[model samples]
Each structure stands twice: as C-alpha cells, then as structure tokens.
Target: MALKSEQARVLRRRVLGGLIRNLLLFSGAFALACLAIETFMVPSIANWVADSTSSWRTLNSSEQFQQILTDQGLLDDANLFDLWVNEAVEGGYTNDAGTITEIQGEVNEMEDALAEYASMMADSPENAEAAAAHAKERAEKLGADVAVASGTNAAAIGDASTFIDDATALDAETDNARAVPLLPYQTILTAEAIPTDDASAAQAIAALRVSASLQELGLSLPEAQTFMPPETTVDAATRILVSAAVLGYDQPTLNDLLQSAFRQSQEQAYSAWLDLTSAEEARALGVSDENPVWQIQYGEDGVYRMRDVATYTFVKSFKLPLALLVFVAGWLAIILRALNRSLRYFDELSGAVGRLLADKDAPIELPADLSIARNELAVIRSQSLADERAAHAAEQRKNELVAYLAHDIRTPLTSVLGYLDLLRETTDLPRETLRKYANIAYSKAERLESLINEFFEITRYNLSAIPIERETVGVRLFCQQVAEAFFPEAAARNIRITVDAAGAGQFFIDPDKLARALGNVLRNAVAYADANSVIAIAARQDARTTTITVANRGREISDAHLETIFEKFYREDRARSSKKGGAGLGLAIAREIVVAHHGDIEAASERGVTVFTLRIPTQGEEIEGAAAAPRIPGATEGVQRPVEPVPPRTVRPASTRATSAPPSATARRGPSARPIPQRPVGERTQAPRQGTSPLNPRNARHGQVPARKTVRDNDATPRRRGLSR
Candidate 1:
C-alpha cells in the first residue's frame, strides 16, 4: 500500500510538472504576441497618421491658435478655455494665416502692376514723344480734372473708420499733417462729363486724376492723413465698416463682416487645399484673401473644427512609447525563434541520450540543418554530438578488448588439452616422444603465461598503473645473450638459430619485456620449423628507427591472416593451437611491448616464408659487432628465410620437424601448418619404400615418427599432409 501511494505521488508530480511547463510555454507565446501588437503595431499606425500633411497642418494650426489664446491672456478657466480653444481653433481660426498671406499677396499685386506700367512706358519705342504729349495734356485741362477726382476719393477715405481716427489725431498734432486738402469742385464734376468733341482729352484727364491720387497714397505720411467725403451712402457706410474690421477695428457688426468673408474664403480654400477638382485646377486657384475675416466672423464653429484636427497631438506626443513598442516586439520575435531552436535542441539531445543508453557504438551524426538553430543551442548540440562520438569510440575499444581476451584465453587451453591427450596415449613411446610432448607442452604453457603478462602490461600501460623502468644495455651483448638462451632448445631438436649484428653499441629499452617478446618469437620458430633448418635473427638501424626482423622457414601465410596475425590467438592455421600445442598469443604480446616502447611491429609472408618485423627509435650509438655466427652452422636451408630479433629480446630458434605427403591426398597427426607435398593414395602404391624418401626417412614412416618429425592434423584443413598415421 505504501509503495502504491509513492508511485501515485510520483506520477501526479510528473503530470503537474508537464502541465506547468506547457502552460508557461503557451503563456510566453501569447505574451510575446501582445507585446508585439502594443509596442510596435499601434505606434506604427499612429505615426502613419501623424505624418499625413493635412493632419500635420491641422495639428500645427491648433497648436498655434492655442498659443495665441494663451498669449492673449484668455486661459482663465483652463478646462473651459481648452474646450473653447478647441472649438475656435478647429472650426474658425484654422486658416487665419492662409488668409493673411492672401491679403499680403494682393498688396504685392498692386505694387507689381505699378512697376509694370512704369517699365512699359519707359521702354516704349516712342517714349520721349509720347511722354511729352501726355505731360502737356496733363498740364492743361486734363491735369485739373484728374485733381478733382483725387479730391473726391480723398474725401471718402477721410470718412472711412479705418483711416479717420488716426488721421484726425495726426491732423490735430502735426503742423505738416494739417487737414489733407479737399479736391476742388471742378475735378469731381469733370469725371461725370460726357465725351464730346474732346472725348480723348476727357478720358486722358480722368486717367491723370487716378494716377495722381495713387501717387499721393504711396507717399510717406507724418502720422496720419485726413480727408472728408462729399456724402456718405448706406452702401458706403457698410463698406467702411467691413474694411475697418479687416484692418482689425473692434466694433459692432465686425463679426458679421468677418463671417461673410470667411464663408467665401473657406469655400475657395477647401477647393484648392483638397484639390476638389483636378490637381492642375487646384494649383491654378488658391484660398480667398478674406478667409481670416470670415473665420473671425464664424467664431467658435471654425475654432472647434481646427482643434479637432490638431488632437493628433496624442499620436505624436510620447516618443518613447512608440519606440519601446517597436523594440519590444522585434526582440520578442528573436526570443521566440530562439525558444523554438531550444525545443529542437531538446529533441536532438533526447535522441542522443537514448542512443547512448542503448549502447550504440555507431557514430551519432547530426543533420547540417542545425545551422539554422540558435547559436547557444547549436553549441549544445555540437557538444552532445562530440560526447556521442567519444562514447562510441570507447564502446568499439571495449568490443576489441573482449574479442582479444577470449582469443587469448582459448588458445592456450586448446594447446594444453592437445598435449595432455598426447601424453596420456604415449606411455610406451620412445624417449624422443616423451621429450617432444613434454617440451611442446611446456612451451605452450609458457606462451600462455606470456600472453597473460602481455594483457596485464597493456592494461597497466593504458591505466598508467605501472611505470616503465628504463636502463641502458649493450645492444650487441643483449642480442647475443637472448640468442644463446634459445640455442640449447633449438639444438635439442636439430634446429639451427642464427643472429646477424648490424651495430656495435649500447641502446635503451625495457630489457625484461623486450626479452620476453623476442623469446616468444624464437620459440615459435623452433616449434614450427623442420629438423636441420635454420632460423635467423637480424638487426639494422637508419637515422630514425632501428629495425629487427625475425625470418623463418615454413608454409607461407595467407593474405587474409597477415592483418590479424599479431592479434592474440590469431593463428595462420585455424587449428595450430589444438594440434601443435600453442597459445597463439606470442605475436600479440610482442606487438604490445613494441607499441609501449613507441615502436611498431609488422608481418610479411610469402611462399613458404614469414618475417615478423619490429622497428624502434634508434639510440645514440648502434651496437658494435661482427656478423653473428650461426648457432648451428651445418643446419640445412628451409624453403624460406628466418625472422630476426633486436636489442634485449633476441633468441635462437628451437628445432622443429618438417615432412611431406604425396600430392592430392590427406592424413592427420602431423605438422598442421607444414607445406608438405601430398600425393594421391592410388599413385603412392607404385612409389618407393615409405621410410626411405630422400626428404626425411622418419617422415616416410607409417607408425609414430621421431619427435623431430611429429605432425598433427588441424581443423578446417583438408587432407593436405600425408606424414601422419
């Protein structure tokens, strides 16, 4: 019951955690979207509105009008004033400046007209004659008539309210500005005269009077000028009032006059500004000069309209909010993209971890698509991939080690079993038989021990559990000594061991390990070799490395076995361990020792010959000696050369037996690896005595031969040798 409760609690916790994670992920996504809209999208719309020319102009006008009201000391009740300003600025005073500009342009047009007249008259072809005639005429009767018309117009201006007050003040204060002279009665009456016999003269006189009055108006006055009209009509009074308001007079009916002007001007202004017709027509027309007058008349209505347009102020007001929105939204997109990448990374990581758990030794390869992932996630992915690779390499190494161990352990056991069987059945055999079986068993066991030591040595080397002891030894002496050690064993079986010295000095190496490796090779050569056959050990050195070769006579190794021959229990003959008594681990141990010394070992085999080569770094001086003498000088040559040894691992070869069978036939109980010539059973009936073959009489026997010719059949090998019964 307690365990069940615990399991349920764990399951609940997992479910809650998953729910929380999912909730957070969705919440983050929604929050990011909201931020994008609030921070960037809304502001972008506001900015677009603010940048519109009509909107911008509306905003500017409202701002200016508000300032005008403030400067006019009209902002007493702030809220009320704001409301009033909004109404007045938007609806009424919106285009006041535009109207002022138009009026100013009218004055400019008048000036331009006057200038054009002067330029045209001055540049005329008959200017001198025309000017004289016109002046004469003006100085006569026409000049008087022009003066009378000027007098009348001056009288009207004197009564006008815009000029009357100031003109009256100036006349009262300045002696030079005493009443502006009223035109004579004759000038006024001349304007009404009908054209008769002197029609041209009358028209010229009227033109002169208008020109003269305009000249007087252009003159600089002291402070004011005064005049009195002959009479004032209602139309004239209204005109006076309207004109006075345009010049900024405060009086009754002023607002009415301004309203009328505003109505007319705004109609024209809207058409031009909005391009109500085609753009070309709009360009040709403009706002009326009287727009401000009309706006002032409309009062609150116009101001409110303008103020409404200006409220875009809110859109442009806060700089930071808009920028903040954009910044937040853009960064949110980047973050979300990064999150997606992280999720992908988690997926890849999960896969890699699963592969690791399953102990897959194959490399875990990542897709190149990872380049699109976030940088940090990419790095994490890369590290995971690297870790997978490392794990795979370790796994492969472990498999190789296991295979090596199994091979090493089984080889010696097979040899031991084979020899034990031989010993049990050979109780009444010859002394040589007892000696041969005993020596072969001993050698096999020794090989097995060496293999065990090699495995330990390799483990220690990799683990750094043991330190190598380096000592100097004479190279020549070391080689000779190791060779002599194996000489007795070789002589026991009538085999010959030889050494060739290529140097004359001392060198450095782990003497013990080197000797063991060399001994294993020599012992192997002796066991597999023929009686009276020679095994040679030779050494040489170049600038970089010292080479030691062990050459031996035998059947050639197949190409398939050359690559793995140094591996533990990797025998050329599949049944070499079982039939001939070997652990098949000698070369493996030798290879390990050489590698520990930072050297290399290789094997090359050809027809009936095999060479095991070892190369190590050369020491300061090479060994000094004559060519080594053969331990057994009278030994006969075999089909192939011998393997050599170097430094402290040199050894002589033990004697071994070789025999041949007739071609095309098979037998057991002989050297499993011997390159024996075999013959068919049918053909052998006509052959000479079996015990009298020139190759070796012992090999020709039917019963058990001497130890020197002992052979054994091997598994996987057919009836290739006929030396055994």
Candidate 2:
C-alpha cells in the first residue's frame, strides 16, 4: 500500500498522452468541417443565383451588402411595403409564372407514372389489347388541326366542347391508365358552374390550370369582357384560363399567354405605385413588374437589424452559406461533447477506485465509448475483492493459531507443575505412588518441549531450502510402500488398506520428500478412517501426467474446514491434546512437496468418504532412482525442524526437559483424546491443586489448593514419552 514518487510522474505522462490523442482527434474532425464549408458553400455564395451579375453583385468594401442597404436611408423608412409587394409578385403571389413552374413539375411526374403503368400491358394482356387499340385510333386523327380548331373558337367553341365530350366518353369506355382524371378537364360541365367571388374565382382558375396541365390539354387566356365596378362576373374574368374544351384552344398552345398572365396580375399594383411617387423617388426606388424584388415580411420587427436587404438578399439569396453555418456549428458541438465525456471517463476511473475499496458492489458502468475502461475497472474490482477475502482469512487463521498455542502451553504447564508439587510433598507415600506422580510430570514436560519447537517452526520454516529431486518410480510400488507403513496401525482397528495402480506408469518426483508427503497423507487416513472400513489407494497415468487418489471411509469433511485444511496449522477436527493430533502442518507440507514436483494436491469428501488426490506433471526431467537434488545443509525435507532447542528457565526443572521433535512427527492423532481447556493470555489464573488438575474431567471447575503434605526428598526417575504436541 505504500506509494512512491516515481509513480506520480508515470501517471501524469499517461494522462497527457490520452489528452493529446483526444485533442488531435477532435482537431482532425474540425479541419474536415472547415474544408467542407470552403469547398461546397463558399463558391455557391460568391454567385448565389444564376441571374446574379458582376454589375448587380458587388463584393467591394464600398458595395458590401451592409453598405448597400444603408446608403440611401432605405431601412430608416417604414414604407417597405412597396418593396415587399414587388418581391411578392416575383414569387407568383400576384402572378402565374411560379404557378406555371409548379404545374409543369407536377405534370411531368404524373406523365412518368402514367407511361410506366400503361407500358405494363405485357403484364396485363386483356387491358393492354384494348388500350393499344384506342391509342392507335387517336394517333391517326385525319384532319383535326389544333391551330385551325382554336382560331375558329368564337364561332365554333360550342362544337369544340361537344367534340371533347364525345372523345372523353369514348376514351372512358376503354378504361385505361392513360385516362386523365376528369376533374382537371371537365369543361363540358364547367359552363354550368362559376366561382362567385374574386378570391374563389382566382383559386378555382389556379386549380383548373393545374388540372389541364396534368391532362396535357393546352389552354389560353379567356377574351376580356365588360364589368361593373361592384362585381366581376365569372364569365367576364379574363384572368381565368379559357378551358380548351370550351374554346377549342387545346389544339394549339402559346408560350406568350403565360407571360401575359404574369404581367396582367401585377400591372395594376405597379401603376398605382408609380402615380404616388415623384420623378426623383421613382428613379431611386421604382420597381418593374417584370423583375420583381424578392418578397419580404416587412412587418417583422427586426428586418432593419441586419440592414433592410440582409434577410431579403443575404440569407434568402445565399442558402448554402446558412446551411454551412449550421452544419459547422453542429459539428463543433458534437465533437466537443464527446471530448468532454472522454475526460469524464478518467474521473470515473478515479472514483471507481474509491468505490472498489468502499462498500459499492455494483459493476462499473459507462457509455459505449468507454466500454474498454469499464471492463478493466470491473476486473480490478473483482481482484480487489478476492485479495480482501484472502487477507481477512489469513488474519483469522493467525489469530486462531495464537489462541491454540496459548491453550496448549498453559494446559501442559499446569499438569506438569501439579504433579511435581505432588512428588515434592507427601514423602511418606508408597514407591508405586511416587512412580505414578513422576511419570505424569515427565510426560507433560516432554509435550511442553515439543510445542515450543513448533512455535519456532512458525517463525523459522523456509520453503526454498529443499530443492526438488526427480526420480522415476512405479505408481503402484510407491503407493503400496506408503500404505504398507500404516498397515500395522490400520490392523489395530481391523481396517483394510488396498492399492490399485494397474496402469499407472512411472512418474518423475522426489523420492525422499515425496515419500514424506505421501507418508503424511496416509497417516491422516489411518487416523480418521472409520474402524473396520477400507482405505483405497489408486493411481493412474496418461500420456501427460499421473494421478494418485487416496480414499477412506470417514466422517465427511465440511466445506468450510476442507478449504483451509491445506493452510498451515489448520486441522479439520481442531484437537489440542498432544497425544491426539499434530500442530496441523501435515497437509500444508504435503501440498508444498507436490507443488515443488510441478504438480498439485486437492481434497474432497462426500457421503462420509474423504478423498485426497495427488497429481504430478510428467513434462520435467526423466528419472530412475535418481540422486537427491542439491539442498541447504541441515535442511529437513517436507517440513522444517529447528536444529537446536531453547534452554528452560533456572526456576523450572530444566534437567527434565524433552528433546525437540521433527514436524513429520507432529500431525499423528490417536484413537481418542480429551479436549484442552482454552483461555486468553494475561488472565490471572491460580496455581492448580494436585487433586484438581484442569485436564482431569473428575476435577471439573473446582480450583481449591490441596493441604500441604509432609515433606520428603523424593528423588525418582520419570518415565519418558514420544515427542508429539
């Protein structure tokens, strides 16, 4: 957890690298947007409209658009309506040219649709045959000249109307896609109806004109008629086109009629404006009906803000520039937003560190742009949790071992001191009685010595001293030797030991250390296996590796205890008696030995049957009864053992101290044993009485000291015992 100064510089460099990369990315996109505006928008604005000329379109400072509109105080005046009207006329509001353009476009679209539909005759044979016949007859028209038919309109308009009606009825009988909608060309019925008002008449005429175009029936303006001041009769409205059916004008079309319509619609307004203006004003502000100004919503409050012509000329005339302005603005906005989010991702990482260490268990989430960062943070959080759990478990194990050591030390010291006191007093006792007290004190002293040695093991064991010594050994022979070592012990309980390694070939391993490892495992089986139940040792080999499985019928190991059984000083049954079990280093040392052989060991239990598996990798050096690998001198294999012992204090019976035992001698358990009384350190406990020892069940909780007995020099040799604590 300690941090160093060098890491800060490294972190800053990483931050700078990411920041520079993102900025360069945004810079590239900005450059592309600028280039697009220049290529596609600049030229379009330079010559905005096709009609623009150098004479009318000046870009000099003196003729800048801002200066042009402000030169004549035009924007200072409120009378901008005349300009607005002139512009309105240009857009076909009071003229028919714009309407004609719209009509031509719509007609073209309908023509294309109709042609494609009619050509589908191959797909619709019956309808195609009838339509083809009618088309053929019309194409061969005899003497119906279009121009001649229209010129005789004043005299023969009624006959023309009848001819169109008859032609339409015959055409309808054919029932084809070529039949244009009658709503556009029903002039035969139109004479009976006329729009009643000027507004209605104008709209009706517009609709009828469009219909005629769709029908491909060419028409001309109606002849003028006399009208009263209060009302303009429909039949007298010259602005309405004369139906080609009513005038026989469908035969010939005149382009000039459209132009005349445009002029007639705006001439009255221009003439009225001319009469109101003087010669001086007309020269500066006059507008022609032919070249109408662009329309303006002059009543709008801010037209003069950009100068009178800014909206009228600048924005309306130069569309690409406005679009370019918006495109560039939006492009910059998007780039900057993403850049900001990139920075936020870094902040999220910083914040995630705190949450990973805190109580938050949720997975770190981010937008799609930060998916990689999100995934990495999630992985870090998981690893942090795993590390935290391992640390917690290790701490718990250390605390438990300290407690066990304290209890083991206190229990034996109490019994040893109690028996020694019994031997010191009561000198008049029988010889056998003296021997019993002496024997009990000597056994306790030996156990206390064994425990102190293991306490040294906790601090002094070094796993690196013993190197792996490879040897090729038959799996069956190797396992049988291990199991055979425990046969006498197993026979005491009538339990059977069996080895089945039929196909298990030779594998590489350390003979001495592996023998110690397998010895540790078999000892546990012989200790915990149910009396009279079979213990099975099986080994198998494949091309890659060899496996040895030791199975025994015993109490099923709980999941919690199974996980920590391989941890140092961890035993499944947690017994503290020196006569019953070791310091719980057997399985841990076994795992170390197996791992050094480039292999692993695992334990599992189900249905009262516990199994320990040992697997060794065959990829290392080949071996045949090989020599031991070089190792540190005085080093013990499988587990560590102190070379020397700590001398007892002068106040105690130092001459009675027992010799230290090897670790392999530590984990063996007996058939049955009493539990040790556990207590915390620093507690003030009274000296135990000779008749009320803490280990004796008969004494229970009574701690009264025994009456002092008669004194005597009771010098007696005590019986020695095995070194197991």
lDDT of 1 by residue, 400-437 (tens): 54465568767876888898898897688887676777
- Report the C-alpha lDDT of model 2 over 496-589, residue by residue, as the tens digit: 8888877777877766667667777877887788988888877777766676767788777665565456555565555555544666665655
> Where does the lowest 10-residue lDDT sum fall in candidate 2?
680-689
Relative to the unseen true structure, what is the C-alpha lDDT of residue 276 in candidate 2, on a scale of 0 to 100?
A: 53
Which ten contiguous residues of candidate 1 have the minimum total lDDT? 680-689
> Candidate 1, after superposition: displacement of residue 198 in Å?
55
Output the lDDT of residue 678, model 2: 16
**TM-scores of the candidates in the order shown:** 0.37, 0.40
Q: Give the TM-score (vs. native) of candidate 2.
A: 0.40
Each model's lDDT: 0.41, 0.46
